[model samples]
Target chain A: SQQGEEDPQALSIQEGENATMNCSYKTSINNLQWYRQNSGRGLVHLILIRSNEREKHSGRLRVTLDTSKKSSSLLITASRAADTASYFCATRGIKAAGNKLTFGGGTRVLVKP
Target chain B: TAGITQAPTSQILAAGRSMTLRCTQDMRHNAMYWYRQDLGLGLRLIHYSNTAGTTGKGEVPDGYSVSRANTDDFPLTLASAVPSQTSVYFCASSDEAGGNYGYTFGSGTRLTVV
Candidate 1:
């Protein structure tokens, strides 16, 4: 079974609108990271928020982690057509060995011009 | 930095044949991982190596094997392909700590077992 799961399998919005995606995990984690994947390409690391941190910002990306609820959310401000892609959330467990990242079922976002 | 590279962008194999997918990372990351992505399903870890000469199974390890003979290379093998195994295979690398830096993924290899 997958440790992390993303909600809202797909989303569609206008170019300038903000898009939000949520992820929930079942175990205690040291950190949570978000990634973007374009068609035919590999995933690109976007932002990582530690368990102790409540919120983080990078460019137009905003990530919030609520360790108490074991969930995280990614908010993309002023989205663009170029930002249309699949977003995935990965969880790194605190006591897990190695650098294993358990990914969730991604949410595909489509931005219309 | 070349990052991570995977070979045979796409491949088609018979159900009973064997094949090897190659992955190499120029970053010299201490940890490397193999994952498979299917439609509607996120990437699932197949195998991983924390360091040279040590490999461990991930969420889904059946029908797959990996070897880390050197720091720069990690290859995954399928000893008898099945249609159920057809999916996009990704190779990723990360620093020793694994969590803080996130992961760097390869371009991915699309495999089809018929």
Candidate 2:
């Protein structure tokens, strides 16, 4: 089942611009992760933010989690044309039977050079 | 490291034909999963195996089957292909079950049913 849903089905931006995407989930989660997929290929793990943590960062990627709101945001700074891809937010809820992850509908981002 | 690898990167099959998508990981992860991604929709789970010899159905498992006879391999089989079954299939594996570690996904298999 789908637990998280991303906002802004698609976005287009110029290279070097910052890109931000939001995800909202239905239930409490142990942690939230963001993944990047290129051209329908396998996903690459970007960053993960635990429920207890409010924010986390990796290089140019920044992730924030708000348990009270059951939402999260991913920010990619200095976006490049190569960064154009689909971003998905996956939630790992405490109640998940076996640590299964529920992925949200991804946000398609296009970085035009 | 090889990480996760999926066989038959792309395939075209006639309706009613049966095929299996192969996934393997060198990570020795205990949890493996099969998910299908359709246009405009998020990836939906088809099946998962928490460990070798244990399997469970995910959200969509009607025409699909999975087996985890060993830790390194998890294959998804389509008993009978249907037009609606065409999508990009991804295989993922995690070191542990919960959210402790991130998942490693395979390149993906693009299957088209005609």
* Candidate number of the best TM-score: 1
Q: Encode model 1's per-residue lDDT on B4-95: one tens digit a residue.
A: 98998999999999999999999989999999999877899999999989999988999999999999999999999999999999999998
For model 1, the superposed segments whose C-alpha errors exceed 4 Å read B97-99
TM-score of chain B of each: 0.96, 0.97
* Residue-level lDDT tens digits of model 2 in A1-113: 58999998899999999999999999989889999999857899898899999999899999999999999999999999999999999988898878688999999999999
The parts of candidate 2 lying over 4 Å away from their true place are none
How far in Å is the alpha carbon of B114 misplaced in model 1? 0.7
* Interface C-alpha RMSD, model 1: 1.4
Clashing pairs in 2: none
| Best-matching candidate per lDDT | 1
Question: What would the TM-scores of all predictions be?
Answer: 0.98, 0.97
Q: Cα deviation of B24 in candidate 1 (Å)? A: 0.6
